[model samples]
Target: MRRFRPYLRGEGLILTGGMTALIAATIMKLLEPWPLKFVVDSVLRVEQPTDVATVIGLCAGALIAITALRAVFQFLATTVFSMVGGRVLTRVRSDLFAHVQRLSADFHEKSRAGDITLRLVGDVGMLKDTAVTATLPLLGNVLVLTGMIGIMLWLDWRLALVALVPLPLLWLATRRVTTRIGQASRAQRKREGAIAATAGEALAGMRAIQALGLEGAVSRMFRGANDRSLTDGIRAARLSAALERMVDAMVGIATAAILWFGAHAVISGRLTPGELLVFLTYLKNTFRPVREYAKYSGRLAKAAAAGDRVFDLLDQVPTIRDRPGATEAPAFRGQITFHDVHFAYDGGGAVLAGLDLTIPAGQRVAVTGPSGIGKSTLLTLLLRLRDPSGGRVVIDGTDIASVTLASLRRQISFVAQEPLLFSAPIAENIALGAGRDVTRAEIEDAARLADAHDFIAALPMGYDTVVAERGANFSAGQRQRLAIARAALRHAPLLMMDEPTAGLDSASEEAVARAIDALSADRTTLLVTHNLALAARMDRIIVLHDGRLAEDGSHAALLAKGGRYAALWRLQQGGRVRDAATG
Candidate 1:
């Protein structure tokens, strides 16, 4: 409730209007039975009543007018409440999405993308729907119930007390059934999230699944989650039905009691037949809220579960955020220093342990290491995608942590190994690296520098050509070149590439290597790769082993030392020789 206050604050006026309409509708409903009571007493029971036909007509007209007014007010309340709820939820969804994007990469790494997506789309949507169908109507019914109860007591206190005898029993049954229903609803939501996660994972890796013929395995996984969700859903439905039926039985018992006792009162001349009819009518109306509650209990419980999921995600403070008093960083000179850096992932051994290294301004260096030896971790630290657990990473002698993240990251351009591309125009994808505005000519120049212009121009839409999902429409070399073009457009002082040519063919690797040379000119560059050919071209090569630097020297010098770098070079050469012989 407190978390939702900010979203509701702006809709106060609209919300008040809705409440006012609901109250007015409740008043109209309370007046509805009175006209029938007048017809029963003033027209039907009166001996030689004056203007009998006129009285009957007036009572009929009043009944119609009361119902029509109630309808109008009810419609206004429903519409206004729906509009306010929609607006509130829209803001919530927008904030949730932005918050998810702002969270650190570590949170994303540990969390399932599909579950996050479910909270964003499915859970929020459920809240919005339940607000309209269950929550708002329930509030309106509660108002009606309160008004009817007051009227019932005013008409005849004895009959009112008799009619409410089953109230405690109804309350007990509701409390028990609603608890079970809520539990079932929460379980159902969890199972549904699992189903979404499984389906999303399968679809995202459909190519791999098809290649490996794991369709049956994936189907079984999805079916397991789906079956669990169905079981929970059916349990909640059954409990909700039981509660509704219980309320119906209670309402029947109360009605029977009201009829028996009120008839005795009418026989004893303690109450008029008309007043007794009004009491019975109010008794029936008063229990309507309880009946509605029983009917919508499952939906309301599901909504509560959804709200819990949303608020749980929103409660997670971002681990990475701008520090207090952090200032924007100046343009970097590109001299980088890692001072005794120590880093580790959660529940894992150190990936980099007290490792010290430095690269002078405008130097080109390659870092090579065995798999899982923290080669890529170096770049992630420099980019502040994850900060070091101990020591500092300094750029131009300033601690990176002292500066705003946006300002610090803007000075570095990184090309990931896989070359991530979103669904956008080819030019837009290139321009994203700029992080600011860039002209068409600049984009084209960057493309040409990366050796991507010829291929991009050959496309039907040229620069305007839209990239398919993850740039799957392009070949490995084309994607790599485009990624290089994006980095080139940034024109940052420090450039980093992670295994950029790892999966490319010989022709594509050569083309991409040339593009890398052009892009890295006069910049501080750090290349992480296993390709010794690319490393040999760098000014220096550093080999990491067991999370510490084992060797660092020029390619020829490292080869002469016959150390870790030399051993890795020989291993790659042997693999190449074997491949060539097979060919």
Candidate 2:
């Protein structure tokens, strides 16, 4: 409810109108029985047969009028409540998605995508159901019950007292069942999320699963989670059924006691038969809502469980958010510095520790290291994908953390080994991150620079050809080339390339290397690679080992000194300096 408070700010008018309509509907419901009472007392039990026809006609007309008004009021009330509930649901789901997008990368890494989707879709859907079927109805029922109880007491206080004797027991039983159902429903929702996650993961990795011959393993995992969800669902349902039965028994006890007392009062001439009948009818009408509440208790419990999960996710403060007083960054000169920077992922050993380095404006620098030696971590730090646990990363004299993330990242261009292209047209993919008004000429020029123009032109639709997810329709080399074209399109002052040619064949490697050289001109470029030949071509190469800087110099200078960088170059080239030269 608190989570929904923000979205309900302007809904007061709609809420008030709905309540008014519900009141009208309840009044009509109470009046509908009166025509029958009139017919019973004044028409059927009358002493004179004369004018009886007129009495019956008047009662019939009253019944018709009450039924029509009730229909109209009930319709208005349900419509208003449903419309408001729907709007609230939309706002809740939209906010949930936007918040998830803003959550830090580490949070995403630790969570399952499918489970997140469940919260966004399924959990919010449950809240919507609650608003319509439970919340709105409960509000109406409470008002109806209050009004009906008042009328019954006014009609005959003794009959009213007898009818309510079972109420305390009903309340106690409902409370006990509701508590257990809530717990069970929570477990049910959790297991449902697990089932969804398992199925999603398996389907997403279907290709790998088939290639590795692990279909049975994935199916069994999905089946186990599905079975748990079913069991929990059934348990919740059973508890809800029992609650309904308890409510039914209580209703029966109240009705029986009221009937026995009302009959005696009528025989004693203290109450008329028509009045007793009206009391009985009002009792049933009031308990009608109680029975409905008992029936919907299970659904409300499930909704509560869903709301808990949604709020829990919303409460997670992002680890990477712009600080207060953070200012937008100006255009960069591309000089970068790492001043005693330290970082480590949760529960993992240090990835970088007390690291110090600097890249001058417009310098072409290459970073080389063995696997898991923080080459990628350096790029992540520069992009602010994750903040350092200590120290600062500065660009053009501006501490990145002191500036807004969008402005800071806008100055840098990155191309990874695997590109994440959307399922959009090739030209759109090339123009991605290049701003909305990028010209066709600019896209073509970038494609040419990345050696992708010819291949793109060869396709039937050329730039209009739609790319599949992850650019699966294209070869790895083509995807890498398209990524390079995207970077070229950005033309940012700072560029980062990570293993751009590592997985490609010799021909593709040569093509991508040319694009890198063309895109790197006059940019403060940082290249991370295992290719010794590529390192030799850079203006300078920095080698990292055991979370510390091992060596930093030009390739020829480091080779001449025979230091760590030279040893790495020799090992990769197998002592063949000629092979390195050719590469």
Candidate 3:
């Protein structure tokens, strides 16, 4: 319900109208069964020959009128309820997606996309049935049940008492079913998420699977996930079937009691045949709703369990957020200083222990290190994708933590090692998440700066060419170029590049290097790469080893130090040249 508040506030009038219509419908329905009593006892009780036609005419007309009125309210109720339910679902999905867009990159590091996707897509949708079918009916039923019990007691108190003999047992059974269903549904959701994660990973890495001949292995994993899903579904289904059977048995017992008591009255002539007939009709009417409620109990349980999972996600506050009074940052001078900055992904060992450094405006700083040595993470902190565990990262002589995230990030642009693209045209994806009103001229200029203009124009449709899901049609180099073009278009004061030449052939690497130079012209840059030759061209390089600053100076200075940086350079250079020699 808390998760639904935003939507409820938006559709308040329509939701209220739905409640009103349901109340009217319930009243008309209760009137319908009473009419049956009148028609049976009044028309059929007469000695047939005398005025039978008139009697039939009056009762039939009244029944038709009352039923028609009931239909009207039922129609209104369903329409309004559906509208409200649909709106609520849309709002939740919208809010969830928007929040994810705002979340810090570090959150994505620790969380899987599929897990967040399951919550957004699967759990949020479960509330649909509750709102559209269950919520108003529940209120209507409470009113109907109260009215039915009152009328039945007035007719025959003893029979009414016998009819409700199984109510307690039915209530107890529903509780037990709810408890079991909750456990099963939660497990099912988790298994489904794992399956989705596996599928997502395999499909995203489809090239790797094919190259490694892992088709059979991947298929087996998918089959295993399918088996787990089916197993849980069967268990949940069996329990539901058992509950329904119990309700059936209870309805049968109540019916038998009605027949037995009515027979006694007939034997004594205390109740006429038509009167007893009407009583049986009402008894059936009473038990019909009880049967339906019993049936829908499973769905109610599903909604509850599903709702819990959804709300759990909705309730999670992002760990990183701007302070309440955070202000927009002023124009940066491009100066960057790291003062005693210490950090670790796990918050244990430091990645940058007591690190101290300063870069003058418009300087190019390259961070080079082995895999998992915090090169990428350092760039992450500079971009404000994360804040340091200790000390500070100051941009333009201002502590980054004091500025709003939006204000801070606007001063920098980044191109990741692997570009992420959307299912849209190349131009649109290049401008993705950028505000409206971006002109075609600007997009083209940015592409030109990144050395992608020539290739893009040569494509069949140029900038308008449709990019497949995640830009599958584009080569790795092309995708990276598009990413660079995107950042170039931003024209921020600082630019961050990470392994730009990764997975590129020699020709593509040269092209990308040229693009990087053009994009970073006269702008402060913090680059992370293992390409020593590339670092040699930079203004300076910082070497990180086991999360600590091992070396920092101009490329020549680091090479002369003859430590980690020099050793790595020697190993890489020898390997490349030796391989060339052997060939």
The most accurate candidate by lDDT is 1
lDDT values of the candidates?
0.92, 0.88, 0.80
lDDT of 2 at 458: 100
* Ten contiguous residues minimizing lDDT sum, candidate 1: 41-50
Runs with alpha carbons beyond 4 Å of true place in candidate 2: 533-537, 570-583
Clashing pairs in 3: 351-547
- Give per-residue lDDT, candidate 2, residue 365: 94
**Clash tally, candidates in order:** 0, 0, 1
Give one digit per residue, the lDDT tens place, for model 1 in 233-347. 9999999998888888888888899899999999999888888999888888778888999999999999999999999998888788888988999889999999999999989
Provide the RMSD of all predictions against the true structure, rounded to 1 decimal: 1.9, 2.9, 2.5
Which sections of candidate 1 miss by over 4 Å?
none
Tell how far residue 305 is off in model 3, in angstroms. 2.1
Q: Write the per-residue lDDT of candidate 2 for residues 395-512, one digit (tens) a residue.
A: 9888999999888888889999788799999999999958557999999999999999999999999999999876889988899999999999887999999988887876788888
**Where does model 3 exceed 4 Å of error?**
47-50, 104-106, 133-140, 263-275, 556-567, 576-583
